[model samples]
Target: MAALRPCTLLLPVAALLFFCAAGFAVRFPDPPGAWLLSLAAVAAIAAPPLAALLRLFGPARWLAALALLSAFAFAVESLGVATGWPYGRFYYGEGLGPLLGGLVPYLLPVSYVPLVVGAVAAARHPRSRPLWTLRSAALLTLIDGVLDPGAALLGFWVWPGGGPYYGVPASNYLGWLLSGAVSSAVLVLLWPRGSPAPPALLDGTLLALAFWTGVAAFGGLALPAALGVALLAAFLARRAGIRGCARVTFLKKN
Candidate 1:
């Protein structure tokens, strides 16, 4: 972590940005392209983990393992979606349409990119383990399970064939274990560098985006899905120390 100053980290980040732009353009083309194009795109998604790994572990060790596993899982998932391979039993709805090699269809990882990044940052920060768990759980539930689906409904994105095979895509959430627990743990293990924290207007915006998009997205398939998410967020916030619960009780008293 000490070696990860902004100046030194600049080049890898620039490369990450470049690859993401190139990958997104090709992989998620307006009409999408052949499997080769999709493969390159899939490969590009590995950039963040790769970049972070380089910074964290620097030549070798645990971060490399996480980055490698993450890339492999992403590869399998992208290929599976493209060809309807191994876990091809499910389907997303028509609203999502056939996306770029089926990769663009789920659009789950976009939301999760920020989520896992934030989670890692938070966990690595000075905080109690239980508090981190509670915070992380609430964050994941809202960001991954709730907000992402909402965006899919608004034409922002869609899960055309995201059949909830036993609740959520086994691939997406499964990779999260690598990102949240394994990757975070690895970072902690290697370096304990702490820095002045940055503010989060963007984070707040993402949360709002998740909320609005979730409402818009889920309201399409089932209004109940939307309403239920709203209620759930309220409940979880209360659980996490948000203080609006008493308002309901006060209203009832009146």
Candidate 2:
């Protein structure tokens, strides 16, 4: 077994702390408390993936990815809020902290970029960029499948039209699909030549799945909870398969 890095432990610890705090915060309504908790949650979720990206791709590439994705997310979100073309009409509440231009949250990219990085890193068959992009986009959508409902329940965002799934419109997911595809393409382009995604990259994604699964279950949203569990299972299975293959290769080499 490969030795675990000390930094790798930070993700699980942060996740657990956030999950516990979130559980309490959800039950008891405290505006100031919720705002602080939400900030903490964003940091906890985003830090690991950003670290992984830096470790894998170096600072220059990491910065590039971060800048580009942040701009893209803000633009798309602003457009969505104003025009409602892609993600449906959604308005943000004050819980997420200050809104940029009174439109989207300032911390949008901090949370958004990590999801794209983690999803692309978790994708199978990295050599095939097209397939990787498609799969990563789908994975992003699935992650949103868990996230939107829980966000709605928590009053992070409100979908005025309100669709079948926990007040989130279907158009929001379609927006995610499009956004995910574009984000995946950007990651693929920025990826270092002849380098595979680091295994540690998925840590952030796993933590997200675990946290959201708990949130969904706590909120009594069965479908989103199930989807979170299923996504976690699929990712874990993929990790296990990769490890098994590595072991076989090592034994053969020996």
lDDT of 2 at 129: 83
C-alpha lDDT of all candidate models, in order: 0.40, 0.78
C-alpha lDDT of candidate 1 relative to the true structure: 0.40
The weakest ten consecutive residues by lDDT in model 2 span: 245-254
lDDT per residue, candidate 2, 1-254, as tens digits? Answer: 66443333544565566556556655763566666767777776776567767866888988898889999999999999889979999988877878999999997887788789879978856568899889999999999999889888878788988999988888999999999999988998888777766555665677777777777888889999899889978765654454422221112232
Q: Compose the digit string of candidate 1's lDDT tens values, residues 39-127.
A: 34333433433344344445666445455435544565566556655444233333334444546444333323434443444333455
Error of 2 at 227 (Å): 0.6
Candidate 1 has a TM-score of 0.39
- Give all candidate RMSDs, comma-separated: 13.6, 5.0
TM-score of each: 0.39, 0.88
Please report the TM-score between candidate 2 and the true structure.
Answer: 0.88
166 Cα displacement, candidate 1 (Å): 12
Q: Give the Å shift of residue 37 in candidate 1.
A: 18
